[model samples]
Target: MAKHYALASYADGGDWRETEHLYVPRRDTRLRLQSLMALGYTASEVAAATGLSPSHVCNLRTDVVHTTVHVFTADAVASAFRDRWDKLATGPQANRQRSKARRLGYLLPLEWEPGDVDTDDTTEMFLSDPSSPETTENPEVLDYVAIAEAIAGRRVTLTRAELSHAIVTLQDMGVGVHETAERLHTYTRLVNRYRARARQDAA
Candidate 1:
């Protein structure tokens, strides 16, 4: 008997029916899930990329996410593996994160005076790499606590509704609210102000 046996049935007059089952590798997909989880991708993100439902992806946990028969199509799994591989192998994030200090290189040129005679200087210099600017601790969320503290210190005032509305706007822009608020502590407030100013300028 062959190791790769497929079921078949034969009828009269050379009529026959057969079921072919392709060999699928017996690899654990949960390990892949764990790796992606470590990279901070949510199950929804994985499902979106692999065409799986969010619940299906959520159930991919080998233990808490589930250890039962949560099988996905081999094609979907393979596509996910390839996508991860490509992301790891290419693009801007291929380089490691730069330090906060190094990212603020734009401030260096501001120190030069009017009589600086370096027009012929061949040495390459950059104020700061605009591609990777210095982040003041939080880049995504405006620091509300800090803003509140500052406002208190400076006697600035805005209604609670206004503040909450601004925060809600951030959440609508793919930010996870509270967490991004913390991560973007200072900038969130600045962003709202900047956006409002831009709208005013446009108007």
Candidate 2:
């Protein structure tokens, strides 16, 4: 269910505008955190993004509100969520997983060995062939703030947060939360998710 409100939102000079439909904090922070994870946030990142601790996020998974949710301050959660809210701009990761789930795949190149990519070093190739007559770049990424914003987009958003929280209503379904990224260069899946999602959403 949606939590909505009609408030006399004021303008700079005191002009009032009515707005409706707001999000409510159900006793379900854990479910929301799970959704945020699927959206590509690491546990620590989600905590940073949502302004809660990893333990608190863990508790949300269990709906252990008596121990976790109540201790979270409103300002902290709001700040964390807002930081991630702007991350909402990010659509998906750069590289997508192969359909029919490959048993194995080529490792990314770190350096050129006689023009052949050497994936031994495990360095990521964040570069994309933008002018390859295939992909488009975000206009904001050309500058510093946009790049930072793009990084933040890998977090979560209010919409995702709401969807995450809604899992509690899913007949008490379990939302498994895990973090697989520890090496910075391992964001291939995330980058692909962003790229694919961006492409589809744009279309």
Candidate 3:
């Protein structure tokens, strides 16, 4: 049996039906999707987890033009993100996804906090230009131990902070700038820039 409900009347005597479809700003949803990819989860994997189509997941992750997303879609993605945020995906596809995300400068899962995920300030931080003078002035902290551990791994993937720290550490150990660049598999100019910054900080 189908039941019909009467619409509530406003003070002016006009009746309106309640809306079932809801939408929300897509910023946080996009970030969550991107973070999942950065953690090595491919679009298909995320789609499988969320029951969303792979194309839909990819669109949401890459399309900044869309300002809003359906509420249910956002909820599904949020659920998947909560479940997989700290877990790194495996396999060749996952490695490809991580490489793509890294090339796009997406933030890693551990780089964001639960409280900061929905904030515009945090989003701006991720989107800011890394080569800007302001960015060069206030660099991320150096962690030599973390850099060493990453270097020791079979698959090496170091963040910009870690790379900078490695260059500085190598230079401090009397390694030539060219040799440091070769060891880190980066450009000589970059090694020089980082070394220059380290010297400036020391001064």
Best by lDDT: 3
- RMSD (CA, Å), candidate 2 to true, equals 18.6
Off by over 4 Å in 2: 1-28, 49-51, 64-68, 71-74, 86-203
Error (Å) of candidate 3 at residue 169 is 28
For model 2, residues 1-203, the per-residue Cα lDDT tens digits are 54333222111122332333343343323433433443345556666665567776655544544533332342244334333421321224312221111222212221112323122111112223322222344433344433233233333222222221222222133322112121112233433434444455459
| Residue 181, model 3: Cα distance from true site in angstroms | 26
| Top-TM-score structure, candidate number | 3
lDDT of 3 by residue, 1-203 (tens): 34333222211133433435466788888988998898789888899988899999999998989899876677678667755653467657987887899899897754665555564433433434434453343344555566786444322456556767777778778888767755665446567766776777789
TM-score of each: 0.28, 0.29, 0.48
Query: Compared to the true structure, candidate 1 yields what TM-score?
Result: 0.28
Q: Rank the candidates by lDDT, best first.
A: 3, 1, 2
Error of 1 at 9 (Å): 31
Go through the candidates in order and give each one's C-alpha lDDT. Answer: 0.37, 0.33, 0.67
Best-first order by TM-score: 3, 2, 1
